[model samples]
Structure formats: C-alpha cells, structure tokens
Target: MHSDKAIITCAITGVLTDPGQHPVPVTPEELAREARRACDAGASVVHLHFRRQEPGKGHLPSWDPQLARDCVQALRAACPGLIINQSTGVVGPDCQGPIDCLRATRPEMAACNAGSLNYLKVRSDGAWAWPPTLFDNPPAKVKEFIDAMAETGTLPEFECFDLGIVRCVQMYRQTGMYQGLPEYNFVFGVASGMPADPDLLPILLRLKIPQAPWQATL
Candidate 1:
C-alpha cells in the first residue's frame, strides 16, 4: 500500500467544463477562491486549466499566456505557498500557446500527455461518443512539449491514459528527450481507455522506468 502521508493535490479547474453548468471555476477570482478552499482542506498542490472568460466561450479552453499568468498569480496570492501545476495538452502541430503559457507563468509543474488516444465515448444506443474525437499526442508533439517545459525549468507531469503511453515515456527517456527524473500521472477511468481499478495500479507501477517518481490520478 502507498503511504497515507503522501501529499494531496486538488484539481481546482478543468479545461472544458462549462462554468454555468458545473461547479468548476472559470475566472481568476473563482480559481483563487477554489485554491484557497483546497489549501484549507490540506491540499499542498493545485492543478489548473484555464478557460476563456467570455460568455459563449466560457466552456472552451484558453491558451492565452496573460490569462494564465493572472490565474496563477491569483491562486498564489490566495494560498501563499501552494505548488502550481499547469496543464499543457494541445492538439495539432502548433504548441506556441502552451509554450507561451509556460514561459509566462513559470509554474512548478505541468502535464504532458505521453501518447495519442482516440478520445471516444459511446452513447447508451451504442453510437459514437461526442463525435469521436482524437486526443493526439504523437512522439513529435510530445518532444515539442518537453522542449518547451525544459526551457521553463518546469517538471513534466506525464499524463498516460494507456499502458502503451507509459512505455513511450521510457522511450523518451532512452532518447534523452526528457532529462532528470521522469514523473507520471496514470489517468484512468475514461470510457474508452484504461479502467480505473486499483488492481491495475501494480501493473502500471511495474512498467515504470527505473528510478522514476510516479503517481496515479483516477
């Protein structure tokens, strides 16, 4: 069993949650409030994903570095010593948004999905889920993210949704694409991806490269 004394991280907000529909905060003020709440609840870290502050775009993700900086500043002010973990997952070849955010915010940590996956879901009627999208994280894309994160001295929190992605981290390590100790976030429980069972934790742990620090976020 893992130690009970491990540090807890509260995910203050996500990228695509509609602020009007869910309790996820969107603005800097709301994010600061949630960060304070999490700290009071004994969380030592906060994972963040900014959303556009406009009305219709409130549900979509934001890649604006200024907005990201403002949100990080607000959270830091709220929780004087909380660790910040920024999200940097983006599709397509353009990584400038995420790169700019990292350079602007200079967060302590950030997420980098290790591999591509068909981010699919199925309806009750057996139809495609949400139009059958692809959360692409090709090797080249992964390298691009790593290079950017390295420039900011930020730790890459490898978000692996599948077992194959976990192995990809090892390959990245072998190629010297990612320096220092590799860290992983085993993101399970997605509808089409790996199941969220503690039973599989051991298997995932076994696949971890030697001397790497790893954790799970289910």
Candidate 2:
C-alpha cells in the first residue's frame, strides 16, 4: 500500500562527539530545545544518547538512570507526542547501566544492537583514527536487552550493522524472541560495516523479514 505520510526520527545528540567542538546538546535544557526544534520541523520521533552533564565531560556517554530520566522528562515536556527512541548501545556484556536506564525512563522505543562489529576507523595518512574496539552484542546480551525492553513496555528497534545481523534479526522473529513485526534499522557508513550506498537497499529488503517496517541509518 502507498501513502503520502512518512515518520521522521531526529537524532539530536550522537554519542562521543565533543560538545566543545560540536553543537551537541549535553544538558536537559539543551536537549529539550533541540527536541522542540526537531518536532517543529516535522519529526515525530527523537533518538537520544545521554551524555555526561559534568563540566568538561560532555563528550563522554553516561548511562546514569537519573540522568536518563531527567533527559526523557525534559524532551517529553518540550515536544508533546514525540516518540522517544533511546540509545542502548554499550561496549560489552555488562549492560546493567542500560537496563537501569530502560527501567528508569520507560521510553517508547529503544535500540537493540543485533550483532557485534569491529568498531574501527582509519585516518587519511594510513593511521588509526582511534584504537580498534569491539562493539560486542552477543546472543545472550541481545536477549537480555530485549527482555528488559519487554518489561518496560518499550519496543526494540533492532540495529543491523551488517547483512548477517539483519538475518539474525529475522531469526529473532522466527524464534519468538521478539513478538510482532520486527523493526529493522539498517546501519551503514561504518568503515568495518556496510557502506552507505542506496544500491544495497534492494538486497536488504529482499533479506529482511517480510512486511516488516525498516529504516536506514547512515
């Protein structure tokens, strides 16, 4: 079925970008203002990544439950009816922080990284931009996150960093790990993951679970 409507989701502040150098919002007030602007510009949803609120630490990510609560509350007040898709991307299996935040905020949606990726980047001069790290999201970890989301009544948007991960999300649906139609989020543009190319969309659509809603993040 065809329609004229599109659901736009705005990511206000991404993770790890220095607030000093970039215009990333670091405080509750700043997040509220940015979210309001996004809603004003026709975005019905906002993807959020909470950051450290302390002085000189705005570049760092924070999973503090209270901080997450404050940010979510601020955004809700600023943008009425805005769907909050909270980021739950962490580096390892120890994900109590994200779980706590999920319980604390009870957001409408949350990201469930479907698989692992070698989070890496290279500088122009054949040098490493940052040390190679693994964004580990093993099966057990993924289950843990989905369970948390189920408890909090938050929908999980499976973030697929690779084609295999996309299939994994499909398996998740078949096995009844996540109920209902899966929301696939195809992630591209990473040096170690899928490239940001529109040509890949056909293959992805063919591979994804039938009739499931999906989006691309580049």
Candidate 3:
C-alpha cells in the first residue's frame, strides 16, 4: 500500500554550522520567520537546534532554557499546528544543557541518539579533517535524555546512524525504558557511522523493526 501524501520535516537550523557564514537562522526571530516559511512550503514539522546569540558566539550551540523557550514559543505562534522536534544530540556524557532546554520548552518531539559513533573524517591526502573524537551516546546517557523527554511529555526520535544503532533500538525498547511505538531517524552521509548510498537502503530497511515510522536525514 502507498500513500500520495508525505509529512515534510524542516530542520531550520543545525548545530554544527556558524550562522554568519552559512546564512542559517540564529536568533529567535529568525527561527520563527524561517519556520513559518518552511511550514508555508509544505512542512508539517520543524526540527530545531538553538544557537548562541552573543556578539561573537554565533558559532556555538546554546543550551539556555530561556533562549529555547523563546524560540519555541515564537515558532508555535508563527506556525500553528506545527510539530516541534527539539535537538538533544549533544556529544557529552552529561545532559545538562539539552535536558534543561527540553524541559523548559517542552517540544512535541526530541532527538535521542540511539548509539555512539567515532566521529571522524580524512582528507584526500590522508590527513585528519578534524579531531577523531567520539560522539558518545552510551545507554545510560540515552536513558538520561529519555527520562527528561518523558517528564516533559515529549516523544523520542531515535537517530540511528548505523546498523548497530538500529538494532540497539530494539534492545532499548525491551529494557522497559522506552514505552511506545518506535520512531527512527536514519542518519547518513556522515564520514563515520554510515554513508549516504542508495545501495545500502535495502540492508538498512531489512535491519529495522517492522511497522515503525522511519525517515532518512542526510
């Protein structure tokens, strides 16, 4: 069976880029404006990442509860009925910033990285593009985020970057920490976890649990 309609999710801003250089929205007003524009362009949901608005701190992610509250409120007012999916994909073992923002803003959904990844990249000359650090999302950390989301009445959007992470979702469900039908975001194009190759879609689909809502984010 196939449906002609699709739910488009717009990620108005990303955490990794500097807004000044990339031209993405950084301030609350900018986010609200762009989010409304995305809704007008057929987006049913808006995935958001809050950024710092200091004079020279635009490149960094901001975890301030007030900032997140402001942005979320503006978006909700601008785009009525739009689902908000907040970003809680921080790399640290601690969930202070992400958790605080989630509890404060209380979005409809929040991203929960299902597993860890050795975030790495190499240039053509075999030189390291950046530090080969670990994007660690251990089971305990995952639980921490989940607990916060649960408290805030938010749904978890598990971000599975590789096959192993996809399988881990089942284990997480079996452990009783997760309590509902699954939601997955298959992330590709990263130099580490999984590459964005169409040839691998079948294998990835085979690895997923049947009857769960899933989508790919490149």
Candidate 4:
C-alpha cells in the first residue's frame, strides 16, 4: 500500500467555459475567490486557465499576459504561498501568449503537452462533434515551450494523452530537448484516447521509463 499522502490540486476553472451560462469564474476577482476556496479545502496547487473578460466572448480563451499576471497575483494574495500551475495549451502555431504568461507570472509549474492528439468528441447519434482537430504539438513547438519554461525555472508537467506520446517523453529526454527529470500526466477518458479505468493504470505504469515520476488525472 502507498504510505505517502497524495497532493491535492484543484482545477478552479477551464478554458472556454461560458461565464453566463455556466458557474465557471471569469474575472480576476472571481478566479482569486475560487483559488482561496480551493486552498482552504486543502488544495496545494491550483490549475489555472484564463478566460476572455469581455461579455458574450466567454467561448474564447485569453492570451493576454497582463490578464494572466493579474489573475496569478490575485490568487497569491488571496491564498498566500499557493502553488500555481499555468495552462499553456494553444491550438494554433503561435505560442507567444502562453510563453508571455509564463514570463509574467513565473508560476511554479506549467503544463507542456508532450504530444498532439485529435481533440475530438461525438454526438448522441454517433456523429462527429465539431469535426476532428489535430491539437498539434510538434517537436519544434515542444522544444520552444520547454526552453521558455526552463528560462523561468518552472517545472513542465508533461501531459501524455496516449501510449505513443508517453513514450515520446523518453525520446525528448534522450535528445536533450528537455532537461532534468520528467514529470508525466496520464490523461485518460476521452472519446479518442485511453479510457478511465484503474485496471489500465498498471499497464500504463509499466510503459514509463525508469527515473521518471508520473501522475494520473481523469
């Protein structure tokens, strides 16, 4: 049996959640409030995803560094010494926004999706959901993100969506593309990727290279 206590992380809000339609927080004040609640509830870390502040523009994500900075600062003030894990996932080629946010906030950790996967979904009728999308995370893009995070002394949480992507982390280490020990995130329960089952955890754990620490999130 595992003896060590698990670190709890609260994902306060996500990207592109309609602020009006849903209860997700949108403004800096709201974000900080939620972070405080998470900290009070024993969350050591808060995973952040900034949303657009403009009303009715809630469906889109924000890339403004100032906005990111404000949110991080607010959270820190609300919950002293709370660890922040910034989200750096972007769909298009330009990653400048995420890079800028990292520089601005200087969070303790940031997510670095090690590989790409099809951001897919389906309808109740077994039809395509909003068409298939290649959430591309090429080697070059990965390298760029790694370098940026390294500059700020921030830890990169490698989010692996599939087996092949999990193995690619090894390749990244071998090629000197990313330095230091690897931190893996096994993300499952998507329509196109791995399922959420405890039975599969052991097999997935076997695929990880030695000397690397890993965690799972459904």
Candidate 5:
C-alpha cells in the first residue's frame, strides 16, 4: 500500500467561477470560514485560489501577494495544522504571479501543471462555452514553478490532465528539472482533457512512478 490513509483536499474557490452564482468564497475571512467547515467535514488540506476582493469583482482571479498571504494566514488560524495547497495554474509564460504567491504563502503544497492543454468547453448547440485558449505550460515555465516550490520547501503536486502529461512528469524527474518522487494529481472532467472514468485509474496507476503519492481531482 502507498500509505495508511488518504488526505482529503477541498478547493475553496476556482478561478473565473462567479461567486454570485456559486457558493465560492472570496474574502480571506470567508475562505477561512469555509476552510474550517471543510476541515470539520474531513478535509485535511484546502486548495486555495485567491479571488478579487473588490465588490462585484469577486469572480476574477487575483495574484496579489498580500491577498494570498492574508488568505493563507486566515486558513492557518482557523484550522490549525491544516495543509495548504496553493493553485499555480496560470496561462502563458509570465508566471511571476504564482511564483510570488508561492513565496508569500509558503504553502505545504502547490499545483504544478504537468503540460499544456486546449482549455475548452462546448455548449449543447455546438457553440463554444468560452473562447478557446491554451493553458500553456512549456518546459521552461514548468521549471520556473518547480524552482519556486523548491525554494519555499513546497511540494509540487503535478496536475496531469492526460496520460501523456503524466509521463512527462517522469521525464521532468529524469531530466533533473525536479527532484524526488513526484506527487500526481490526475485531473478529470475537463471537456478537452481526460474524462472522469473509473476504468482509466488502473492504467494511470500502472504508468505512475512506484511509491509516488497521488490523488484524483474531478
């Protein structure tokens, strides 16, 4: 067995998800409150994504280091010993925002997108749900994130959207971009990526490096 137990992680709020429509928490206090509730319900880790705090702008993502710090502090105070998992999935190359957040928060774990993907979704009428864009995370960009995580002593939870990306993480370790056994986060339910299929677990597990910690994100 890989371990004696499973660590449950609850995502507080996702980027671009409108708080008005959903129950996504925006402010630091709100995040802390929700995180406390999640902890009480059995979540030991809280995945964090800072959102804009200005009124009516809570739906947008925020990379403000101060905001990230505030949120982390609040969560720590509300739920002592709870592990923090910061989200570092950003598009394009300039990853300074996530890097800054990693330094400021010094979270126990942070997401490291394993590969690029065509972030897309389609409506019932064949119309695009949102403008098609690429969640670009090239080799250079991935390295930058890995370095930041290392500097902060943060574990990189490799977010693998597909089978090939899962393998890329192994290459990352082999190529010396990152050291130690990589933690895997097999993401599903994305329209353009892997499906939420139970049967695929066996294949993914087979490909993962032995004794590596892993989890499924849906």
Candidate 6:
C-alpha cells in the first residue's frame, strides 16, 4: 500500500448477525484469527462486535468485560499492529454495557452511532418485514458515549447513516462535545437511511468537515 491510499477497515463482526450460520466469530479464538487474516490482507483496522456465549444466545450482542479484554489481547498478539475498533451500538437508552466494555478494554477506537434511525425493512409482498424498531441514539446518549470515549483515550468514529446524522457530527464538534478533527463513516444503502449511490458520494463528502479522516462503509 502507498502512503496515499485510504486506510482499510474490516468490520469482522456486526450486531445481531446470527453466528449459527454465518462465519462471524462468537469466541475469542475465532475473533483473533479473523482479525489477523484481515490485517494480513491489508486492513489497517478491524471493527469488532462481541457476541454472547450462552447457549442459544450466541447471536445476541455482548459487552462482557472479560470477553472484550480477551479478544483485544488475542488480536494484539495475533496481528501485532492492527487497530481495534470496538462496536458500542445498542438500541434504547441503557448504554451501561457498552460503557463497561469501553472502560474495561479501552480499545484504540469505538463506533459512535451519531443519531437515531428507525430500523426498518420491507417484505417483497409490500408490507413490513419486521416491526419497525427504534434504534435510538439520542443527543444525550451520544454525549454520554462521547464523554466515555474521551475519558478512555478512544477516538469516536461517528457512524452517520443518513445526511442529517452526517450534519450532526459537525454540530457535535461545534458544541464542544468533540474537540478534535472529526472522523466519520458515511453509511448508506439502508432502507431507512441514505441511499448508496455513486453520485451522492462526492456530495456527502462535501458536507463533512474539510480534510477530516473518513471512510465509506457499505
């Protein structure tokens, strides 16, 4: 890779994706192995989401402190220099789990879901696929997460799923909640979020703080 190439972030695991079928890691061994593979393939960072180990609960997200620390330590040993960016997303107002993980493990970076989005989907039959869930990340909650990250030396990578959420990061910067050059992820192509159109990429890029480090997460 050249010095000019954009840093690649491999999201090795995601929220609520059932590990029963998918290859997403549900244990520390798998997490470390997958992270090493991504790093060897030129990914500078790996975004991680821990899952519960209890029987039948392997699909649900977990913020267990021990799991977080074990995964981080194993990843560091396996990859040597890969960046660890832990997922801190959870629906509703209870953020203690995420906060606990952040404080306990204190990864190099953490995902800061910038705003709320009505988690939506549609069936092929022109009806709701599932009940529209409120994936809440209100200002107060965002502030709490940001403050926690600040305390732990973790850089908050704002995950903006929509245009308004993209703009909100700027507001967060101005309102003294964030004091450094912002980092952003312009997430699109979701049913209830911004469209993932090529033409819109530049437009979205233009809306962000000039020269801020950013990446496009498909």
Tens-digit lDDT string for candidate 4 (1-218): 97988888787776466777788887899999999888888999998998888878766778899999999989999999898988999987899999999999999999999998998889999889778989899999998889999999889999888888988998999999987788988988877888887888887788877768888877
Q: What are the root-mean-square deviations of the candidates from the true structure over C-alphas?
A: 1.6, 1.2, 1.5, 1.4, 1.5, 1.7
Tens-place lDDT digits, model 2, residues 1-218: 78768789898897688889999899999999999999999999999999998999998889999999999999999888999999999997799999999999999999999999999999999998899999999989999999999999999999998999999997887888888998999998989999999999999999998899998887
As for candidate 3, its clashing pairs are none
Better of 3 and 5 by lDDT: 5
TM-score per prediction, in order, is 0.95, 0.97, 0.95, 0.95, 0.97, 0.94
Tell me how far the alpha carbon of residue 134 in candidate 3 is from the true structure, in angstroms, after superposition. 0.5
Query: For each candidate, how many residue pairs have backbone atoms clashing (under 3 Å)?
Result: 1, 0, 0, 0, 0, 0
Model 6, 32-73: lDDT tens per residue?
A: 999888988899999999888887787888888988888888
Candidate with the larger lDDT of 2 and 6: 2
Clashing pairs in 4: none
The candidate 1 region of ten consecutive residues with least summed lDDT is 12-21
What C-alpha lDDT do the candidate models reach, one value each? 0.88, 0.93, 0.89, 0.87, 0.93, 0.89
Local accuracy of candidate 5 as per-residue lDDT tens digits, 49-137: 99989889998878999999999999999999999999998887899998998999999999999999999999999999999999998
Error of 4 at 28 (Å): 0.8
